[model samples]
Target chain A: MSVTTIAPPANPVERFLRTDRMPHIWCPGCGIGTTVNCFTRALIDAKIDLDHLAIVSGIGCSGRVAGYVRLDSFHTTHGRAIPFATGLKLANPKLQVVVYSGDGDLAAIGGNHLIHAARRNVDLKVICVNNLIYAMTGGQTAPTTPGQVVTSTNPYGTFDTSFNLPHLVEAAGAVYVARWTTYHVRQLSRAIAEIFQKPGFSFIEIISPCPTLYQRRNKMGDGLDTMKYYKEKSKVKNGAPTSEVGLDKQGEIIVGKFVDRARPDYRELMVNQMHESLGSRFIDPVAAECEEGEPQGCEEGLCS
Target chain B: MNADPRGVLSGTHFLDGDHACCEGALAAGARFSAGYPITPSTEIVERFSSRIPTVGGTFIQMEDELAASIAIQGAVWGGAKAFTVTSGPGFSLMMEHIGYAVMTETPCVFIDVQRGGPSTGLPTLPAQSDMMQARWGSHGDYSLIALSPNSPQECFDLTITAFNLSERYRTPVMLMMDEVVGHMTEKVVIPEADKIEVEPRRHTKKSPAEFLPYEPAEDGVPEMVHAGEGFRFHVTGLTHDERGYPSMTPQTQDKLVRRLRSKIDGANRQIGLYEAEGLDDAEVVVVSYGITSRVAQRAIELARVRGIRVGKLRLITVWPFPEQLIRTLAKRVTAFVVPELNLGQVVLEIERSAGSHAHTISVPHAGGNVHRPEQILDAILEAAK
Candidate 1:
């Protein structure tokens, strides 16, 4: 008869997660959980204001990041996370807003927003998990699904060429652009943390496994196999030109921080333009939040 | 709740409904807007984009209506009074986010300066075609507020009301306009900032540890908190529990759906805003809204001169349908005449509410323009007989 009170597992990442809703919807050997684990580590290491951090996600398996992250987060409508995060950052420039979504969510239906968000240089950290297929709605052909890859919709294999996201973001004016995989956990975390200090749009594309559908159909085995493949084939070439860093059809994952430069984010540009146009009368909406006597904007329903 | 004097124009100016709507949003403390420029509704955001910088907010021209709609929701969470304006095509695109706002109980406004559609049927012309769409375009079982303004002045007035109702209800409020009103120019007085009463975002006073994001107050509206203020609450479009965590169970779905329905349905009486005239011993009642209400007013006058005892009920708040008023009036009036720019949308609700008590007649007009006073007068005269 042994009556012993055992303590819970002292996992550091548990604090950042809504473990009450654990045993997530992701399939066995899913890489999304690994991405989340890396992100949590990045958040912890960044040592930024957790309260000021707000995560926005679109509809997908990766979109569940907002639900799990113990932060001011929003799981918005599909493919609108970038613009939503743009609004969040612009509305309150003090907020460290992040858009975490999937390839189907970000690069397909959300592609326009992704490019425009980059163009505007909205201060947002965007983490796009590319499983190379629409895993949530079944193995539908995603914009990132490599050519000749068979999907639910494309049994004949997709003819469309996949987007090189790091190149796309860099070309669209992102101040920071990086690519990593679930296998590159430490580098991904460091890269994610580095982007925390950078201004303007920062993008990190995580190439992950879709074992249940993508791997099963493609005959690429499971997530562990994908991780092993990444470990063996992934090339880390930091500061490589974005144009030349695109993934090859031969399964060589070109992983690196391809671009990092200084640029005024959307808020700074707005504030500057407003100061020039409206002069002293331009009571910055973000600044207005800190004023004591100047009719507090967030009262009642006036959001800020 | 006075508006920030800086944002308020605070003077009389000849303005169109679209422009007036913009000023109204500004006066009501809207500091952020995300929009896609579409016909009729473009002027609202066009004016807002230029004016917002002066007033200290953000105006983002999103790539599409879907992004625009959801962007405002994010801005709302980030502590900004936010909105988006669009025409019919854009409205259709925004339907998804409208449902999302309802599901998440986020406060925002969507101004639809309606153009003819079934698929871009008329981009530049007026239509009341989206009346039913405004009420039910968004999927799922949730209730929302919709207001119609007849004149540029009412446009200014009701846009503020729409924002206030959105704040009070914690739902996306629709400002349903037509091309005529949206494009028509008229004198609109911008009231003093202190004179305009605006509802402050009802922020939760409870500490973050004690707060449940979806937990409702007596009014069935949960108090809100903005992002970056240390309230690490979650909001989603999914069926969520009081903690704002998604719950897919039947019990959770039933509780959430019922509350969504009852919150607006039960408060229809209080939410209803309409003007009723000539009800006593009236043989006919003319029911209309938006620009049609103006034409209906003329028709009601012409019918009165013709000795037709026609009463007028000009609806200002359209959704939640003012069902009780229509039912009660049906018991008294001999007949009810509904004239709308669209062919029989709100008329369906009118007929349903009238039931067997009164004869319901719809004077339908298919898009492109407002009804001729004669057409409505003829309906009123026929109903009176």
Candidate 2:
């Protein structure tokens, strides 16, 4: 009797990814892929219409995520992803816009945009994968590099104070804020799904590994060793004040869903303020333009 | 295509060039704009912010020029005719994003209300100094369309043309307006929507399976699909293949860059727009654009009374340089008298095109002010000699 082998079911997340574009440019043992895996899972769990999802990225290793995902993606210039996504979200309020980029791309070069987008509370979801170094440019010192970490630009260890991303964005008025690691895939994916359902500027900072340049140069071991460290050191502190959650070299890692509150987003304020001032004369242009309203999401709190 | 009637203001109004440009954008169906407040150009956005609410669109004051520049591109990909306004300093900050727009073939407009620059030299003064920058400001080998308007009426008219060109070509179009035209108040008649022409975006007719994001039609321009259109297209600043995936090979680079340039260059005959007067029997031809063109017209009049057979060629489409016209004009004319607010920017192109056939005289101005008609009249007289 001839034995027959049946192929197991294809991974559900594969449908969400552009597997043909793989193997991605990411290096061996890079945690970016792991974070991407979680993001795809989050997209599945959220049950968002795949057609209505758009991903924008800036220049960096993490910026390459736009190419790997099977969504309407844009790989824009460095430091402008948030504003780009802001325009995208405002132009077509029905689309779920997400900005995926790295610490250097977001916190260093794009810091102003990050704060302003949060301040306006534009309806966008930003995923910042902080690897503590600019891994794409051969490990330059990033704004989020821990004190005393040796990077390519800082041979004697970095003396610059790092950004507590959650604290910064929370203070800037992001309605939802969270922190997790590549190790906490389940929890991180859940947090990402939550941001999709929420309706304002939401941010999640994922602590990922850069074994090629960051870990090897700093003697922090490889990708597996970094995961071991995360498992041992991470403290699951839900509702922890953002100010106390700063990362450091060989220190406690705080990871959890930190801030969850409601505030009117940029679009809401624009519509509400304009409607009150202009009265019946004002029609929501996006709504007025669409004939069938097939991609409809503009009608929220317009009359009231 | 007919414009959306809701956006049309449909009445005569005494308006500044900046405000008229805003009305033109609305009439042309630009529902999104992002800008930062910079002098001269700020009035464009100031008018837009208040007017857009009534028109049913969105206007944002971004954190800076960099944000403003890229934000409009985001809106363009999201299925809206979009633009951003800025002056010299802001325009300089927007160069990288301009390159990004070109690389991705994102259709949009950038309005640079020209001012004295090389760094914030004069905030409220006129200068045509940005003409060369408008052509080659962004780093790369690429081509773009730029329109220069001399008055508030043309400002209102050319801005609509800019939007149509951007959509038709799927490239960024620059409206290179000087501070004089931007701030000058004049009579501008707002035509009804039925009278106005707008180009609807070239969305693909092919199904998602047959569409390749970067594949060009016969015109060398690709059709666009908005973000939520189920096409799932990818656009990147990196050199890309027909599928919109990054293909870093030099072969892909050569093919992509060549197409970017050839699309605009090959359409030179159709893209070139100018007003030529007395060129049939003229010894000297005066070339000018923007506010300088209005000044040159006076100079041409003065030269005619002085017995110099002087003609006028007022440029409306400044980029693509109108080289073919200049080459043809050179064969008949003795010399070309080029007067501009800047110190000899466009004159260099005149010299190149008129090589060995005719003399090219540049009437340069440092530009806090317009050229006195006498200054250009003397150049015309000298060119005739």
Candidate 3:
């Protein structure tokens, strides 16, 4: 069988995408590209109005995802994407705010934001790319780098325990929590699409490969070999215990959907609170004008 | 300050520094305040949270400083003048968002009631160590407008000023108050609403469809559009073009950085708000800001009575350091005395700006106790002789 080469579609979705700066600074065969593809596909699949989608990302290769998206995106400070996304979402609940970040960017430095957003169940989606190592700064040891892994910072091997992200998300009360690998493109894309469809705080952790950093140092070969490892290792069973999945020095990877549920979202709660506080005045023009000048009134002691 | 002839309003009352800042934000029309309570600054948040809702604004106790800062940013984008208050550790957490506000050109106010720290040192005590951090803490080469208040009245006045400058410049303005000013109680007259000049944001007259959020106008400040207004501009941490999309080209990066730097720097003349006392034909100048400046003013009087040539230069806007004024003073004065609560922070800026023309000395303290007027007077007398 031969694969047919067809001319690219005019007004290709990729054209609306940010592409002039590529080839991206990401390493060759980096999972970031696959994750980006999945995200764009998910966005397209959901048929979300692109004008109303706000993609926010923090510092890291994964953080660069926002820059490549066609929507109103914010590439914020290191480990600060969740909070930035939270602000974007709260400012205009009409917009879909999605956070694209790396494990270190989200779980490590931005750990507080992730847990709080989940606890509050803010109306946002966080697609965390867990490449295990901090790939952007030449593979420094990261919060997700498994025990005994060696990197530039952890030259003597990592003694620090790694974060179990899906469990953390689940524990933090994320309405949706799932894990998938770049190898499972269709599954990953589908997971992103589904998570985007849900309202509350949905979290999708993508277990991606860091070929240049994690692979080369850990002897996982190149990108193809890494994907193959993921292909062989990942268990498709739902709700499998994390302990059930293990890896040898050169072993199989594990990936699958973990959790899906529902809870009261932050936006709905905020609107309810606003209505209760304002009563019938909530819809009054005078109250609306008062809302506009309320800050000044508070300072003047009139409101206090 | 004299009370207005009109009877005190129902909600008006004599309050402390922290409460006054809250009042100032309210007066200047801050509709949202999101903050994680920290010492000295906590009262501001507590009072704001309780009072904001009554006024039809929102006060959110965010999970942390990071969230708090971002929440306020969201409120500002929602078309509300918003603010957050924190101290030391919380300020450190807010540094990243401060950079965000600068990059996105969002108008907001950050009140850092500074405390002693490398970590969480002296939460209750006063310290001005965050002054330098306020100027350049966020890992970028951008200019900011930071104001320090010397009294409770100034605290109230400057908090309102901070928001005004924020809206005027389309950048985050830092209210760098310390523990003393943040907690000290004093009488502050609540001015009539109409008497206060509240500057609404410089909204683009051009339709939202034609708006480029990051494009600088002739005044060097970019026009801002609220999120629901249908502007299609992007906001990013990366060096971006006028359209707000990431632009990696050297020329584009240069323009972005230059515009960010120049917006505040170019407006330095107008934004270099300060107060000078007794500087004409004086040989000794005592430079100070925030609460310590009050003590410095008293010290100047003592030195004057003692037959010493003494003057005072109080910095109102600290970030765009009043270098032009400092240079002129340095040429005329034999020495500059800088008295601050922190152990020699702003003194460094004073010394640098003074260059080789004047001898600069620091009267540093960590603020468990206030600097003595006699001590500063003695320094002035020595400098004069």
State each model's TM-score restricted to chain B.
0.99, 0.99, 0.95
Q: Which of the numbered candidates is closest to the native, going by highest TM-score?
A: 2
Provide the lowest-lDDT 10-residue window in model 2 chain A.
A295-304
- Evaluated at residue A199, the lDDT of candidate 3 is 88
Highest lDDT model number: 2
Model 2: per-residue lDDT, tens digit, B1-385? 9988888889999999999999999999999999999998998989889888887789999999999999999999988889999999999999988898889988999999999977988889999999999899999899999999999999999999999999989889999999999999999999989999999899999999999999999989998889998998899999999999999999999999999999999998878899989999999999999999999999899888988898889999998788989999999999999999888999999999998999999999987989999999888878877
lDDT of 1 by residue, A172-282 (tens): 999999999989999999999999999889999999999998988988888888889999999999898888876643478889888989988877787778779778877
Supply candidate 3's per-residue lDDT for A248. 34
Model 1 score (lDDT): 0.88
Ranking by DockQ: 2, 1, 3
Model 1 residue runs over 4 Å out of place are A1-9, A248-250, A292-304
Give candidate 2 misplaced runs (Cα > 4 Å).
Answer: A1-5, A291-295, A298-304
Per-prediction TM-score to the true structure, in the order listed: 0.96, 0.98, 0.87
Cα lDDT tens digits, model 3, B22-136, are 8888888776788897897999989876665456556667788988998788767656788999999999988988998998888999999988887988888888889989999
Enumerate residue pairs that collide in model 1: A299-B200, A299-B201, A300-B200, A300-B201, A300-B202, A301-B200, A301-B201, A303-B79, A303-B80, A304-B79
**After best superposition, candidate 3 residue B47: deviation in angstroms?**
1.5
Best model per DockQ? 2
